[model samples]
Target chain A: MSSPSRQPLLEVRNLRVEFFGRRGRLLALDDVSFHIDPGEVLGVVGESGAGKSLTGASIIGLLEPPGRISGGEILLEGKRIDNLPYEELRRIRGRQIGAIFQDPLTSLNPLYRVGEQIVETIRTHLPMSEQQARKRGIELLQEVGIPSAAERFDHYPHQFSGGMRQRVVIALALCAEPKLIIADEPTTALDVSIQAQIITLLKRLCRDHGTAVMLVTHDMGVIAETADRVAVMYAGRIAEIGPVQDVVKRARHPYTHGLMGAIPEMGADIDKLTQIEGAMPRLNSIPPGCAFNPRCPSAFDRCREEKPYLLPVERSQVACWLYDETGARREAAHG
Target chain B: MIAFILRRLAQAVLVMLTVAFIAFAMFNFVGDPINNMVGQDTSLQDREALRQSLGLNDPLVLRFGRFVANAAQGEFGVSFRLAEPVSRLILNALPATMELAIVAALLAVIFGVMLGVYTGLYPNRWLSRFFLTISLIGVSLPTFLIGILLILVFAVLLGLLPSFGRGEVVRIGWWSTGFLTWSGIKALILPSITLGLFQMTLIMRLVRSEMLEVMRTDYIKFARARGLTNRAINFGHALKNTLVPVITITGLQLGAIIAFAIITETVFQWPGMGLLFIQSVQFADIPVMAAYLILVAVIFVVINLIVDLLYFAVDPRLRIDGGRSGH
Candidate 1:
């Protein structure tokens, strides 16, 4: 997945998102960059307000007012999409990049039949007649595991349970068979047991459809189970990005290390789970040097003054001075 | 669906019966109808004979039963003032009031929903702001004052419309319609606006707020994310959701238009039920007064029933979940 020779399906380069408020301009996401390869699941794991969802929203061109991408080049298959006009961007939205939000209860319009919504989306991007779209809608519904797809087609969103509605949403997102699907906390609102079902459904769908996905969530357990690569976001910046196994087993960034440590392991002998000491910083008052420096256990003099961008560290790209020459030499001497 | 409607109809019947009882009660407090019908010089024998013939001498419950029976047969005795059948007077005035109300309601709903959606979609646009400001005036101004102002501008200044009355109505059997004749249509313009302005503004404001609220919902965001065109997203997705509330307000407002067209009728001297009711009040015409109150109640009941049915049609959640096997 990290093979640089192949062109990525989606590339977000040095993305910066800012909010204009009464207090003046505040940077929400600064220089956040990552890529998702075709048919790959790139998990974006972060705490709330970590710009995980914001990144997805920005990519899909649905950022609410006063929050905008101030600086970034969002290239979809080598074409710039960040600067496209609304009409053009809309044409690209479901046709090339689809989105799935957190709550299935509120995601589908309650007034429309689940089938009608799917059919409408299909017809919007594809040159299909209503009947054709409807047929495809039923097939897609079946594909997403909705029981009795044809019968469920006429049912309202309220008729479906939370998990079923999410399946309908996933069916809707995949209507046009877009290159990528942005699942923003798709299972966060589902039951713990149903969450695994949805995750499995999502994983199988992506594989079958060959659709790349930007899986944004705070659940590391979900990320570990489903994602091929994972990017750990800390205060609107990518603290680490690499193969999921490497990032989870050998987290190069301290924030990623602290994050992985916090997750409780089954059958472990520890009495208390590892907990990060400080809260994530707010946008207006994020620390000057590295946004995570205040909370970093290895923070030294230089770490407090200069921000570190993504640098190659083993198999992962880490944003920490601990991976630099001095730190490496110190580690060598200690070893 | 049939059961829902049947239940609503049963409720409406209950409501209408209750209104009829209240109307019946009004006759006792409104003074004797015989006194207004007869002269002071009439002998006691003659007065007694008239009362006996009219069923006034009967027991109260029996008289009420007869009254209810007559009312069910569409016979509301005779008006004390006009000395004609109460049903005929209302029938004659019914067309005028109904025409005025329907026209006003059409104007209100059409323009109200349009302006509301426009303002909700683009709250900062200059035209939207202008509509909003105009709505504020519409909502704040009294109906009579609005009617008078409309007459002043269109009738007095421009001399383009009739200041009073239903002009040149064409008779089509029992129904006299203002829709066919040109002068009749022109005559309707000022009074309808006067009658409907408040309701129009109310509907517009409700729709605008509802549209704004619906536009911000997660479904709307998902609709946009799904690449539906702006028009489809706003009107199809957002507007459809706004309709359940809009229908409720618009329905109630329509009933208000018919019931409260009194001021507009008085200002314009339109030959409608409102004007007839006012005249009946002046003359202490108990029969006509009671009939008018009952009619208004019926209108309210029917409109409310319609509103409830519209809800069932518009919102699937309100419908009993018919078919499903949930896992």
Candidate 2:
């Protein structure tokens, strides 16, 4: 067994996901690679069709029909779990790697009481007495900041407000004390005020438990606030990734720059926010060569002719030829 | 909930009264029950005297009022043909018909739900397709035809069971070994299958469609994300969500089953209320037919009320106003 201190909780490499559409097979995620060290929070940000959610679903082994991982290796605690049998995959899910979904109302079973759901998830992986499970369930509920956890355990999902239900969902996810948690837009369904509360709760609880999280969202503000490291995906591939501050301050990829520019700055005097020049290309009509080449403002002949690999750019990785220092230097000196 | 029940009960009473009035009007339209019961050879004086004695000579309004009063007191006037109380005859036949209908419904619901769950979970698979084909055949085939086919297969060809009629009514208590015996069950099989086949098929298709819809819900997907096994996701999450529609269809079909019982009873020769109903119609036993019609109408109303109540029980959201649509 690997020591918890040295080993990363989850590692994903060269992951490719595809969906069979009427036109042809559409690639949702292409050559996606990332790792979540123990207790790390890695935020994945992208446009609607950029496959951030697909990556999270693939990692949790919950990809639905018509969408499947075509090529990938998902390692959990140094064990390859990409091709594990569904039964084994289920055992690992919730117990080894918990998940919190975007919709709070749906993430928890409506028919069951919040407390009962938590207890059930706890007992699913642990051999414990019902009383013990019940106690632990209450503790988790209280830990998640739900008031009167004992009494509220009997309440159904509909009885709770949207924020409270999300707290319950988070509690249910944490019941098994899994090493990793994949939260897919966990706060997107809540109001703006409640969104901050939930994010704070998630950060606090995960930090206390030393649980790594792969937070998938389109909200850059959420990434800036919560993510330790950030990965920016564009058209099924990671366009850039690095430390949150590095990526936010010195974003190398044009897509990342466009995303940052689109956000409204607090002190800026600009009359209107800067929007990207064009919409993200449709899945079926993705441009040839580099998927982002058409969208990139600084595209050159080489960018149009060959797809650029994710090369190191300063403190971050950028998949654009403009950031290729050696090639830039040679062109500059010769010209 | 109490208000709903009271409202439903009031509606049920109105429906029963309407059914009674219709039955009476139909009887009157068919001409004198006395003339139909007696022969043409009877003297005119005797016919007039018989009509007066039977209260047929009274005005239409007076006769209707009298009929309603008598019905309330359980005196469905003496059967014109049998010369017995219509109430007594209907009471005697009711147990047999109720027995058949109840057992058939039970079997249908059990088998239908099982088949529906299986097919919904594995749609387009061979087993599901096979069940789908079988259910289609069941839906298309009439109850009497299915009954005759079952008798031909189980009775005539194999001699595995009796062709018709309830076996000896052993003098044991109602809940005795005789009722529990394989012999009693063997006698009931043909009638039950005949009565149940159509309902079974109807329910299976309804349940399958409902379940297929429920399986696509976000909650089911969330359950899978929670690491629930496929069986748990299908049965625990999807099946429960599908029950409201199934319950509604089952309740509606119960009314149809009552109507079907008449034909099934005639085919099988089981001395149920349905058979009694046909015999009364042929012999112009007006009282018995009216009583039977009223009883069936009451059963329909009661079943619908129960289904409405069940909606609240199955889905908590329905307890609040406008929650049924949410589910």
Candidate 3:
């Protein structure tokens, strides 16, 4: 754990992303909010359609066109960034925040030398000559554990193996020493064996640099292994958020509980790994009350009639009606 | 690289030999050059002498071999109608055609890629729509028709340019050029554009589609997330990626430009190899035709070789993959 004196590095409030097309409007993300303190690793876990990647993209100001931030306030170090002009946001991108994408192959420009790319990125955000940038780039490559960093600097992406290329991408993301790094499924595209190595590298890098990380992924195991705080998302809304240990050991929201149930224990004799009832709702047909209500096993009448907001529930924040006093009262009376 | 060029050169030489053989054989099938060159009133004995003197009496293979040997020495025999060295005619006419093609290709690439990149970037913008309309018009119109339209607009209506001939020629020992004077460039304008119109649109459409495709790739998204400026992402990343295909198309289209400059040259009365080819065909000038064929083939092979080398330079992936496969 880090010091409690530092403010949260990133704050997202009521982040709503919508896709507008000629057909109509589709709400992709609704009222999603979370914050990452300096040097903290916050893992966002969800199914494929849970808008985990979209939230990551929106925070990095790289949301694909037509799908945009319709309503939200994203602040980096207390300055609202969601509404800044493009140039200003661009300046903040490498200078204050960096991003690590999923696939290493596509994350790099195949036409450029890896060293030159890192150098260019360094030069773009920092006041440095080519020689200085090149020197720093080599240092970063070495820091990321690339062998013969100086010699490998002249090599292209195609010259490196997949794991080595991922290492270079990590080096590229860390070149500018940003306060925050948004990693969207950074290890999912890596080999299974190499995934842990990258995770450990990221944790070490963040810890050493005091850089906060927002790790987006659907792997609960990864969240458990690395994250300080875990947010479980279902159908574009966060079902629960809390310290990883507390949430994993004693889950609160039914959706989070179902997700945890699906992780097979080591050599445990069980009927089968538990399965969540239904697929995440499509953007157009997201249920009115709680997006997870249709698939929630403990859903009561109040869960269907009214949407619930995140509320403090003993060591975690839960959005389930079971945590609400009025909802609990109604359920007891009905029983 | 030198070894690669040498290998390519060897291949080009083989192709040129085959092309020369085809041209020589093709001549025998055409109407008798003597019948066209000499009047019908000429005595039969004299006509026979003319044919013999032109080496028509030799065996077909021998004749073709002689033609190839002379071509190797840069001596393309003599033209039937022009009664001059075929090499001289090509040398004299090449400058004008080359000047036209080079300027047109340069201008076409600049405008086409510029328009294509923006149009692909913003397909719905009014400027893109307008450029797309221009490209459509360019694609539909024939070169001769485009030439006529330019003449009407810039020549007759505006009275600002010339419509015929290669302007005033400035002879410079073994070479003469029309690009030496202001009037020469003025005359070249209408024809160069007319010849370049189709290529421009073809290149525009190619770059536009390539740009659109590259924009969708994961690298572009990754580049955006890296916080690259819009200009860097568009031109540096997207445009550089699009250039390979555009360069390829431009290379092939440049060959086509040289091939079809005949029509444009005829319409505008520009003195170039294309017009020379047209005149030689009407006169049944076999040597000139054979020489022009070989020249065009060499041009195409050389251009393609350049394009391949450029591909290796522009894309390191190509170099890496190609190097591995080469082993």
Best by lDDT: 1
Task: Report DockQ per prediction, comma-separated.
Answer: 0.69, 0.39, 0.49
Off by over 4 Å in 1: A1-5, A326-335
Q: What is the interface RMSD of candidate 2, in Å?
A: 5.4
- For model 1, how does the per-residue alpha-carbon lDDT over B66-145 read when each residue is reduced to its tens digit? 87888888888889888899999999999999999999999999999999999999988999999999999999988888
Where is model 3 chain B poorest over a 10-residue stretch in terms of lDDT? B318-327
lDDT of 3 by residue, B111-157 (tens): 88888888999988999999899899999988899889889988899
Expressed as tens digits, the lDDT of each residue in B51-95 for candidate 2 is 889888789889888777877787776788788888778777766
Give per-residue CA lDDT, model 3, range A58-136, as digits (tens): 8888888899999979988888999988898898887788888889878888898888788878888889999999999
Ranking of models by DockQ: 1, 3, 2
Model 1, residue pairs in steric clash: none
- TM-score for each model: 0.96, 0.92, 0.94
Winner of 1 and 2 under lDDT = 1
* Model 2, runs deviating above 4 Å: A1-5, A21-23, A326-335, B27-30, B33-66, B171-183, B320-327
Runs in model 3 deviating more than 4 A are A1-6, A330-335, B32-59, B320-327
Q: Tell me the tens digit of each residue's lDDT in model 1 across A1-335.
A: 34656889999999999999988998989999998889999999999999999999999999997999999799998889999999999999999999999999899998889988998999999999999999999999999998789998998888899999999999999999999999999999999989999999999999999999999999999999999999999888999999999999988888898999999999999999888888999988899889998988989866788888899877789999877887658657877
Winner on DockQ (1 vs 2): 1
